[model samples]
Target chain A: MPLVYAGVCSHAPGITGRKHLADPGIRDAFYAAFDDMRADLEASGAETVIVIAAEHFANFFMNNMPSFAIGMADFYDGPIEDSDWLGIDKFRAPGNRELSHRLISEIMQTVDVAYAEEWLLDHGIAVPLHFLTPRFDLPVIPVNINCQGPPLTPLHRAWTLGEALRRAADAVPERLAIIGTGGISHWPATPDSGKINVDWDLDFMDRWCRNDRDALLNYDDLTVYADAGQGGFEIRTFLAVSAAAGGAQGTVHFCEPIPIFAVSCTIASYDLGLLDI
Target chain B: MSLYYVQKFLYELNRSADLQAAYVSDRRSVLDGYTLSDEEIGALVDPDIGLLYVLGVNGQILMHFAAFHQIEWHDYLQRMRDGVDEHGPVREGVYAMTGRVGTGECG
Candidate 1:
């Protein structure tokens, strides 16, 4: 089956961890958007969701990092930070080793990818799941791009990974939903944590919604760092989703700069129905 | 100088509850295994959020270390700013502070 859903969202730890500090008006609005995304995802009847996230040194470290990796475990446990600190309780989400095996087998044909039997979910995957799969009933296949460490995966290669994922998804019988989660333009974890570049974010989202490959791939890391802060590096996740959308246009459901959350708090998806697949 | 090892230690400590407990019980024992300068060792043992930030430890790794020590979010941000104020700029890595600090813009 073709991908049932394709979208992107923000997954900063602050989104869940520091919600109490944000303005109630904007916070509720963002929460409502997430709820709407959940509704759309459920309406798609997606059996499993493939979360493409840029993990912040949770499982993969500099010692041995894969440019791209997919989860292949029966169960995955999460939020690694303290429950009180992240404001999300520790929970184990289900995974299907056999299905992952099949998907990995397919995705590997085109892109050299790593498969992990054990994955500890960090906020990159945790925060998004907290809203997208609140019940933890749906199986999830976690994907990671090297966004944290230097020598990160190049943007073009990230696009290839998306194409590989779509090909793999199409090969499977189960309806798959893919979501890319990361910040657009903000500095996370440092003293400048909540600083957001609204203009940079808007420009990037404009490129993303148009599915303009050249425009999206045009950004260099140095320019992105100067304009969008280090967190902008995570745009690889978004670009991959754009590539997975396979030229279908997108819609920005919600986008607002919520400083306390440390991102432009966004929710957007592709019009996958436009594709003939 | 060995920012990699410094981050490696925090990376391990952040993920393992057992290591966190062991480090809390005997930090020196845990510190002995890794090749670390006295400053790095002090930063790890004292768990100085600011000094560690200045030493070029990625915020993603340093934030959990701060949380483990029970540092509040705002306090955590303030400590990093204080670290930079006293220690000059980040000596290495891509996480160097580029924006103005203490501008009341960030939370």
Candidate 2:
């Protein structure tokens, strides 16, 4: 059976490697985290990775959509935006078809979705990929959850999808690793700009990496996610990763306040039961 | 397998309408393609899938309870592994309810 190693990721343009190259402090943290994660990923021996995430307008437009989408491509590349901050134009990653198609067909019964044979790498993927497997050498199976608009899958649904993905991965008989990307807190709009929910955000990170769903599920009613904060959606991605990790405890690598933007720059990794890969 | 539970959940969510239509319009197609009976779809989860899916489900999420009406972890994992045989639109309009990706119809 395959093993899942998952965690929450920050999507702020300033913290992610592709968008923020000039800031020395953040750049170092980002690179160090990437190196550590890459070594861990390489050590894990997982030839395939299934990434669960929420897309920010990187590819899909307003008209065409999929609640759940799987990416099956021959090669995947990144650096979502080409800001001078990051000199590198692109990096490589692997793609798998047999697994992606199987997962898509399986997800149809629960919700409407589609299969994308091609994809343009975005920040959500780029940031994590840069750290987990910078070489982009491993084949990746991308799974998407629509977190932006109405009728979006609730946080709970996102978690379920993670499990479904795990099932899909396990059936393959291949060494597999799973990662969920998004956030814990920090809304990205001007009106609410500079707002940071330290308590709620920090609480989310603590409970999540610890695999404490009881603490997290209770927050469905928490105000930080609904009115004062827009992170409720992104938080779902974190839950998915926790779910994929099968309740494995995680260690927090770094957590610090990001200026101007309410987004927190944090990095952490979870325990996947398999031996390295 | 909790077929009855899944049936009730589907009815409540109006997903049953889709299932019914799938069943009536193309019996064999639905059976071979997308429909996985309770008996058929309950075996895929070994440890990895079970842990991931269960992580998403706390014993308390309202939908989790509601979902229990139809199938359980075992069955869901099996469906994930086997997939459906029927042909249908992979993308539909309901996904637009949430706007992460662009929304449109897929035929």
Candidate 3:
């Protein structure tokens, strides 16, 4: 399958309905860009989408966290925390089981990745999907990263995992759309939890838009943690998507600093360079 | 102090309708079941976002708890600010004050 589309979006729950809580202009600008991005995504003519988002200990508790896992089930009843407010009705989505199986087997056997048959579409996956595919009709393949757990997945490994996903997508004979959700910067739960690392967030966005993979991958996990705050680790998902896109550089849809949520919510589109390797 | 029980309490309330009903009808009695400290219970029952934030409950989880209480987004946010002001710089957990809130002042 030719990887037809790739992108990243930051997950800030309040934006779906409670956006009035944020600066009105920032909210309006983000949605305006996001609506345009969604239209482009809809126009991409993709049949199956690969959604890589964080699994916030919702499905697997801290006791049994996996660094990386792909859901193998045919359907999932989306997560609780976000479904309540995001206004997504019949909040379950059918999975692209065949593609998911291909990805799971390919990554597990070849790359030694983990697999899960029971991961609900948590806010990590749902918030972006709510905006990208509002009708819930698109068949999705949900891949998860451990953004909040310890013995953290090294940053480089996340990028390699993206490369693996690219290889997997190369094997399939269909058009694939991939989305990595979460991050720019925000510390969740800390005293500075609402603090946005504006400089850091913008720098990361600029590099990603420019497809500066070398610079992005050069920063070690410790550097990322120190600069971006705890929840900022979600950038691993974004980088993974960038890698999956063959490091194809593209336009940044929007990058708005949402102070209320303390998140630099973003939506960036990429040129999908179909990989043959 | 471990924010474990507080997060656990909020997680159940977020996922289970049964817990929601129990928490509302007999909030203390329901809290009695969890292995929470008195302070945790006090803050939770008060539904004090400030105290909970001060107590080191993760914002991602705490936000849901605030929403369940129908606290507006803006107010839940302000409560966190109020937390630092009243509780005196996050007494425990990951957000412990590293001697003021700026870089180059690192511990």
Candidate 4:
């Protein structure tokens, strides 16, 4: 049971300064932080990274939307929507089709996952992976958590998906590194969208990293999220991965406020003990 | 229903560089294609940030629309307040103000 690396990431920090990418240690710490994660990932003997990211109304719109989209396609071409800002070649993305199928069936027990074969990774999926590893060869099982549309997936349902993924990973022989990529209180598309609530973001980080589900999920109303920012809902992605990890505690790799994108980007790696494999 | 139309327009604008360019060049023609109400079209073209949000234009779509206009985050939040002052309350969207703006009532 090689469920070695499990954690959450934020993608906003390095977006504005492509220039900082030149000197990985320059303006942002995300580059160096990823370098460290790369070392850890190499040590963990983990092969596939199951990226939990939200889609920005790219694949599904008002006409057709699903709570979840599981990618089982053997091959993936990258970036369906133009993400020229990322500066990565969106031509082809490495994928793990088999594990994706396993996840679809596992997740279907509780939540019906719309199986996707032809779609490519969005910025939510591609940006983090590309930044973490220079080449992006580490196979990924992209889980597009639908956060864009209304009737969005509730926190509980997202947690259910996380729990299912944990069981699926442990039950099988695949060493899956579940990485939830998004959030820590920053709104991407709102008018005050660029403002990151450091206080709220830090509160979430402390509770989430310490596995404080009681405080984390104590919200009776979601306007609390709206108060934080629109992208605040993206944390549902984190909750799913957290549930998958069985509420295990993890190290907070880095949490920084990147005002350029008005999103807090971060990385944390968890070690959930093996399940009688 | 009108908010849905606004959201659709912005959603398309977000993913399409060509559409963004077209929007900036001639918003009137691009907006005319959509069957939006005068209020909806006016809010969009005039760049009424708050009214658009109150009108139920989902934040996901509205934020990018705000950015396209180079609206600062502070100004964007203020615009919503301004909309309350100028355009009445959020007429038919998610942010429709109930009892009072400061009150704990919004449905």
**Predicted structure with the largest lDDT when compared to the true one:** 1
Q: Which has the higher TM-score value, candidate number 1 or candidate number 3?
A: 1
**What TM-score would chain B receive for each of the candidates shown?**
0.90, 0.20, 0.84, 0.79
True contacts kept of 3: 0.20
| TM-score pick, better of 2 and 3 | 3
Report lDDT (CA) for all predictions.
0.91, 0.55, 0.74, 0.69
Cα error, candidate 1, residue A172 (Å): 1.3
Question: How well does each candidate superpose onto the true structure, as a TM-score?
Answer: 0.97, 0.64, 0.87, 0.80
Candidate 2 has a DockQ of 0.01
Error of 3 at A147 (Å): 1.4
Candidate 2 residue lDDT tens string, B51-75: 2222221111112222333443234
Tell me the tens digit of each residue's lDDT in model 4 across B1-107.
46677888988887778998988898878897787988788888887787786677766566557767877545656676566566565555333422113121110
TM-score of 2: 0.64
**Which regions of candidate 1 deviate over 4 angstroms?**
B96-105
Candidate 1, residue B54: Cα displacement in angstroms equals 1.0
For residues A33-113, write the lDDT of model 3, one tens digit per residue: 778878878888878788888767677655577888888887877755645465454488878676788777777655566
* CAPRI rating of model 1: medium
lDDT of 1 by residue, B1-99 (tens): 788889999999998888989998999789787888999999899878888988888889999999999999999999988888888778877765353
Comparing to the true complex, what docking class would candidate 4 get?
incorrect
Evaluate model 1: give its lDDT: 0.91
lDDT of 1 by residue, A135-226 (tens): 88999999999988889899999999999999899998999999999999988998888888998899999999999999999999988988
Sort the candidates on lDDT, descending order.
1, 3, 4, 2
Looking at candidate 2 chain B, the ten consecutive residues that score lowest on lDDT are: B98-107
